[model samples]
Target: MNSNVIPFDFDGQPVHFSLDGWLNATKIAARLGKEPTAWLRKIETLEYISFMAEALGFNSVPGTELEEIKALGTSAPGVKKRILELSKSTGMVRSRAGSSGGTWLHPKLAIVFARWLNTRFSVWCDLKIDSILHGEMSTRVQLDRACKALEDRKSQASQDGKGLSSWRWDRSSLEQSVGYWLGQVQMTLDLDAA
Candidate 1:
């Protein structure tokens, strides 16, 4: 496993990697030149309602929806109700109950949150997401290529009349090479192996 990558299993498919500590609100806010509190408040406002509508498959904000959303309170109870509604609709955002509790947004929603913060931050999030998505496939391809190369090297060595001890040495070398290649791949993909 690479120290730089944190693997999260999504839907029990190929492991997804998130850059270490990528979701800290403070860090995101700092990057966007906004206070975390302000950013969080913005998330709870119109932006959140917009996300809910889109998540619920509404192409456009439904009639009077914006008015209703605006009318919704921003007090704790109001926020809690909204979070519950959103959870029922998409299950993508939630509010925790407790002193340490705060609203939690899925990565996709976090990206939307970033977009709400600033256009530059939004673009950055998009690139990061794109990298994660494409990096998985690229890393797999590189690993496959490395494995094939190692196999070819071993076959060539055998064809050259390598002795048993030589074959064992080659195997050891192959293991080390493949290990190193995998480490590089993991680093490139920002992924930790499961």
Candidate 2:
């Protein structure tokens, strides 16, 4: 839908709602020196919930990691119990094993939890304009620029027949350039996102 912007997509959609979006809220609170409760209104919202799912990469955390979560029969019970509760509430759990160890939530949802954990903006990024200086406006502007840069690169590559190498998230429309990718990295970082 974005004409002059690079649409962040997964599997071809027009959005990239990473877990970091919400999880990073905690960081926002930390920076604001607030109780971190005001922004919690989204705890029950789609944005918050979606962010959680995105944070947990594969949905359910690995059973192996669960044990380490709190040493099995110990203080971890509460966290484990909550995990189970959420499991029953949703089918987003993604479990794997061996080389693919560790529980993962979607990047977006994870961002919410991150706020719960850190409440620090250092985890997210602050490119083009610092969030402290520009807040949402500057960040949004930067995202727009990034998206446009990406789209322009994609169009040029397609015309150049650069071989259509896979870009982020299999986004064929994305331009191939290390700097572009680097900016993406910086963005994710600035957001203190996952």
Note the clash tally of each candidate: 0, 48
Which digits, one per residue and each the tens of the lDDT, describe model 2 over residues 1-194? 11221223222222222222212233233444543333222224323443455465434434454445435432443653554444424434233243322233333334444445454432442221233233344444555566676776566657655535543343643434434544655464342221
What lDDT, from 0 to 1, does candidate 1 have? Answer: 0.53
Candidate 2 — which residues are off by over 4 angstroms?
1-20, 24-134, 160-194
Q: Candidate 1 lDDT, tens digit per residue, 1-194?
A: 13333443222323222342233334345445665455444425445645654776643234364456556655635664553453434544444454323454455556766677777656766665666555566665666677887888777777767554477667777778778778876677554464
Total backbone collisions, model 2: 48
Q: TM-scores across all candidates? A: 0.43, 0.26
Best lDDT among the predictions, by candidate number: 1
